[model samples]
Target chain A: MMQALVTCRGLTKVFGKGELAVHALDGVDLDIHRGDFATLAGPSGSGKTTLLNMIGALDKPTSGEVTIEGTPLSTMSKAALSELRLEKIGFIFQAYNLIPVLSALENVEFVLQLQHVGAAERRERATAALHEVGLAGMESRRPSAMSGGQQQRIAVARALVSRPSIVLADEPTANLDSTTTAELMELMSRLNRDNGITFVIGTHDPRVMAHSQRHIEMIDGKIESDTND
Target chain B: MNNFGILRTIAWRNLWRNPKRTLITLIVVTVGLWSILAFSMLLNAWAESSRQNALGLLIGQGQIHAAGYMDDPNIDHLMPPPDGALRDVLDSDGVAHWVARLQLPGVVQSEYKTLPITILGVDPAGEREISLVPDKIVEGRYLNGLDDDAVIIGANLAKRLKTTLGRRIILMSTGADGYLEEYSFDIVGIFDADQGFEDSYVFTGRSLLQEYMGLDDEIAQISFVLPDESGLPAMIDTLKAAAPDLDIRDWKQVSVMAAAMNSAMKSIIYIWLGIMIIMMSIGIINTQLMAVFERTQEFGLIRAIGLKPRMVLWLVTLESALLMAVGMVLGVILAVLTYFGFQGGLDLSGFSRAMEAIGSGQVLYPQFAPADFVIYPVLIWVIGVLVALWPAYRAQKISPVEAMRHAT
Candidate 1:
């Protein structure tokens, strides 16, 4: 049995209170091992994104405890949590959130820099990440100068540059065409297998579910089914 | 990367992102500072020169009179002429020149006019050292040798009495006693000291004054000149100790009106400074608020990348400081050029009479103290930084999630 890199026990998240209260996540439990490539699929207003945010430490759960590699997130201070996020977890968003003013190389280097990596080493690692993501000759180009796929590739490069333990992606391919989506999923799948990095993606796309190794189906604010491919 | 270095790079780049906006703000600040510097320099120069001219033409470096002479300068309080001991005291104290003078109120009668005037009895040789009489002669010559009854009338007084140089005039005044008396004086020269009051004076030799007033060796006042104006105070102290029976008067004491004018000028400068500081502060505050509002989303992005709230504050402050630095440099350059341009000599030909009436003539020059140039810019920088604080505080309060969501 491989050790679970992320563990959640009876996790719950609620928004508002009393008469206005909305239960965004209700009692859920999950264990994700190292090297697992998984997808959480649900319709709009489902709890898949909320679960992903809690796992990524971007949001707090209402009831249950979540731990990344045995460090309970509830016990970590704000600064410690930020450091953990910087050094251990990477995130990719649906909108391709790369700084518009920075070149592709600088965008990738930003994460490494936040982790306090030295300039020389940061540049070398960022370049290698860009090359691995098929953006080798586009380092100097800004986000506005690049196509949507290229910008997404730069975001992927930024996430992978630090070799983080887990990558949490929320609707990462929501804006891409079918071809670009297939290509992006293929690249992510290869990186998952080749580097043995864990991935937790939240999406409603059938293509994302087809490519994922495991799929967790969510409805309303709770998990309806969990299945292995 | 070190936070400060990263933030500084961002701050520098941020200012240039909106080049036109930054340039306009810089121009406003620079023009404000330039006006302040130019006005202060001009007023300082005008006041200083007026003081110098007044001291040079009317009062000497210092004056000596009997104990109560200044309070009521009647002829009865006049002292005897300074002897060799007094001359030695003057020499030891580095006095460049000393003049013995008798001042009295009198009426002048010429061929076709009569006018009241202030009579000044002087030793021609000694008067040249402490006064501007030699160069102030607008019509005729200054006193050469003490002829028994030679006199020099001021340009305005001569005009009033309808008299000219080398003419004889009757001067009537009370003697040392209460009795009215009259004497005749040969007009040797006419002088114009570029001041209204000075242009109305009547000067004659001390010996002729003594004979006319029936006071053989009595002197009303003894005035001394020093090479440096700054040395007048020490010289006054020296004179006080040497001539205890006489009262000492420095240029500042003799010209009380100049002191009042100086005080008023300083008050005006302070008022100008206050107004400029307030105006610049308002401009700076506006610029900072706009900068914060424009960069809110950028700040949120950086904050999301693990930048602390304080780092955002520092970045805004650094931007303000950089802008003020650029403005201060430009302002100082402009001020220096303007100061030197006018100081190189500006012609006030159109306002000569007005200046002469105020005791400044023909040319107006600008000047500044070294401290003003150094301190004023630093003060502007501090005010700018302070004005940036409100925006910095607003930036510090922005929530990363809220800011990122709004995209503003």
Candidate 2:
């Protein structure tokens, strides 16, 4: 009965047309509630990543609608969508996309700065965000100087610093080892519990599935099953 | 952080990511600008010396002649010496120095050769202040008095005539009576002027020539030298009103070749500017475009993090502005040092013959104008920013999809 932070109804995505047509997503319905730590687990070429991108407002769906907090994405301009992404959503990629030239602290502060936060508050919030993710002493180090787990932690800090409504992570632990993956998932699960920030992760890792409150199985371009913990 | 501050920080950091590329582009911009500055100074030095050399050759800064004197050089086209109100005008502060000369086309025969030349009948006292003939005496001495009856000719002319100092020569010209007048004169001085002037002119005292041609108190022209050319127009107007019967002309009008040379030099400078702008514009476009293309993923990352496309454009432009500033500073410093290297003057003595052909002297002192400093830097910044816009536009077109990729 909790309010849905994101709603995907009969969503479909097609990459090409005619004989060369490829369906990246099929008709699917899903609801992501506030504070839900969910995972869309499937093998490669499934529609889980496409679904994540649709809900993140990063790409458009071919049919059906994606509504974030009752605002339909189809009606927004590119600028409005970008503003929505800045204000409402956070993203973590498997590759850990951080600006190489920026320090870990600067990476964390990047979103807050985009939100036009003041320098004093931006630094304070970014410092606290890094500390919350157990990266307190590594704030000034660049991504190249940090390990895969540390860089993912910095990415997590960057995502959570602005207190976005939903965090859409696409295979965020693909590059990490089992120990680091469990540690990162536990840190994210704790943040999800404490901050009430919803998480929608797309992955096939059982370790990731074990930590989620809900798990949806995807095959090809459609959702095959949905289950709750 | 403020919006521009954030943008500037990223832009500044982006430049040093590839230090070699940045330094190479910096050197290109620096050398391009420095060449414009240093070459302009060198050209200006040569132009200034050529103008001085042209002005010194008997045609001071301005001149006054009888209404038809320049049209015909005989005694029939002569004007009365400066007197009455005209004398007072010449004595004013506006006129630095003035000399009366009865210039006539005549023949000089040294027994071995006969050459046609223009004879300048000068006042020794006045010529000392305003004429090259008085100061260019390489042998013997200048004419001493109005009745001295001695002539000064260039060393080249003396060699042509097989004549030397103290040698007697026949100076013949048309008299006031419309008959041939012949006078004997001693070669008092052999003056050495530039190549062109050296071979065509001979100088004698005004009174001696006046008496010899049977025309007393009549002169062909009165040349005046001013402190500078800025007051030349006003001085011309003042003389026109004071001496309506006489024709007044500026040195530019009297020496048409020098005027043409000045105009041609200005055109060449504009051509140099055109060439520099085209070359530098292409250089900036390529360098800035390469820098933009190399950071496509980074651009996309910033854009995905809520940076607007226009802001990406601004970020790229900021990077170019920084490069321009560094280049301009380096260029000005290098140009100033290069100018100082010519402190003693850029000696063209090795090319003395070539220098004389164009009327410039052997030694040239290079100096820059204040406008060169202000104009060159401003031009570089404006042109650089404009030329960098294509790359910035490409940066703005980076899609958010690129942000998903790993850095290269």
Candidate 3:
């Protein structure tokens, strides 16, 4: 039995007030264990992305708790959450988010730089991460110079370089073509299978669900089905 | 690089991303500082020239008169020459130079015309050290001695009297007995002074005037000049101790208008500088806020990547600081060049009449005190960084969630 890395109990998120309020998330209870490759599949306006954001500590829930490795996010300060994000979680965005000013290697090392990692060690780790993402000699190039696929790979390298326990990718393959999307899905699946790193991705694509070990379907902010179904 | 190194790298690279905007803002800062320094130097020199002009014309840095001579200048208001004790103090190191004169209101009559003037009876040797009029002899020689009896009148005075060098003139004044007396003297020198001085005063021998007035060495006043006016207060105190019965007055008291103008010029300079700084600060704030808006996603991305809001504030602040530093360097260089370029003096001869109206010279030589160089850079840099906090605070208040919306 795998240990639970993230546990959510009755999570809810509301936007606006009273008659005009919106329930972006409503009573979502779920568990993501270590070594599990999970996907929160839903249609547009569903609460999959909101649930992912709550787990990432990017947004707070209205009336629920998200426990990451047994520490409740409700009890953490904004500063402590920031430290937790730096040390315990990695994020890969759909738009291939990379600092335009920094080189690929520098972008990868940016989080480590904030973590107070020594220069030589951080450089070595960033270089290894870049190689693992299939971008061996492209370490010095900027994001603009790389193709969309290569840029997304650099984003993956940045996420993995920080050695976070879980990488929450929000629609990571939304912008990629079928060929590049297949390649990225396979790469992330390999990283999960070989390294036992947990991955919780949010998407509506059935192809993405096919690669995950656990599929939790959501509609109108509630889980409609899961691996148990 | 360390954390600060990362921030600096980002700031420097971010500044150059839009080179045109950065350059424009930098130019504003540069031009502002350059104008302040250059204009300050010019005004300082002009003020200095005004003070020197006020001190040189007739009022030395200070003067000594008989108890009531300042209020009324006549035979009845005369005082005896300095006694041994007073003379010793007047000869002290504090007194750079002193000249005793018998200045009286009188009339000079030439063959063709007659004009009213202040008759200044001066010792020629002592007068040269304290007065520029003696050295400003353009037509004839300065006075010779107390026994020479050769009068040196202003060039304009000579014109009004229809007189020239070697011409005979009769000077009439009241004697010690309250009776009118007169003497004939040769015009030996005609000095071309400033516009006002040229027609207002005439010079003669001290003892010769004393003889004509039937007084044995009684004089009206002694005028003193110091090497620098900075020591005037201390030296005036010493001079007062020596001549307790006589009246003493510093240049500011003797020339009230010049003193007031000096203060007014300084206030105007500070006010102008304040206005320029405010304008520059507005330009900086506007430029930086625009830069912040353009890099909104970049800031959001960093905040999501574990950079706290305060660090974002520092990052933006550092960017502004770098911009100001670049401008300050160029500004200081340009200001130095401007100062040296006008070192020979900025010619304002076209405004000569206006300058003369204010009793200043035609050329203004820009100068700076030692303190200006040290204080200006520190003050400008500190204030410049402080003004940038507005944009930095705006950057800090951005939410990390904006990163997802503006991920591109």
Best by DockQ: 3
Model 1 per-residue lDDT tens digits across residues A1-229: 7668999889999899999988888998888888889999999888887888788776688999999998899987656766777777877777626766678998888877767789899889999999999999999998989888888888888888878888888788888999999999999999999999889999999998888998989897788888852
User: Candidate 3, overall lDDT?
Assistant: 0.86
Model 1, span B50-162: residue lDDT tens: 87777777577678888888888777788887766666778764787888888877888888978777778787887777787777887767877544467877777777777
List TM-score per model, in order: 0.84, 0.92, 0.90
Report the lDDT tens digits of candidate 2 across residue range B312-381: 8999999998988899999989989988899789999999889988788899999778798779778877
DockQ order of candidates, top first? 3, 2, 1
Model 2 ranges off by over 4 Å:
A1-3, B68-76, B107-116, B162-172, B180-184, B402-408
Score residue B223 of candidate 3 by CA lDDT. 87
Candidate 1 steric clashes: 0
Error of 3 at B123 (Å): 2.4
Q: Write the candidate numbers in order of decreasing lDDT.
A: 2, 3, 1
All candidates: interface RMSD: 3.3, 2.4, 1.7
Predict model 2's lDDT versus the native. Answer: 0.86
lDDT of 3 by residue, A155-210 (tens): 88888889898899989888888888898899999999999988999998888898
CAPRI rating of model 1: acceptable
For candidate 3, write residues B1-408 as lDDT tens digits.
788999999899889888998999899889988888887887888888887776786788888888888888887788888878789988877678998899999988999988888888888898778888887899879888877778888877888888788899999888888888888888888887666788878888898888888889989888898877789998888888888888988988877877898898788778877887887788789889999898887787777778877889999899989998888889888998888888888999899878877667789888766576657766877887899999999999887776566763
RMSD of every candidate to native, in Å, equals 4.0, 2.6, 3.2
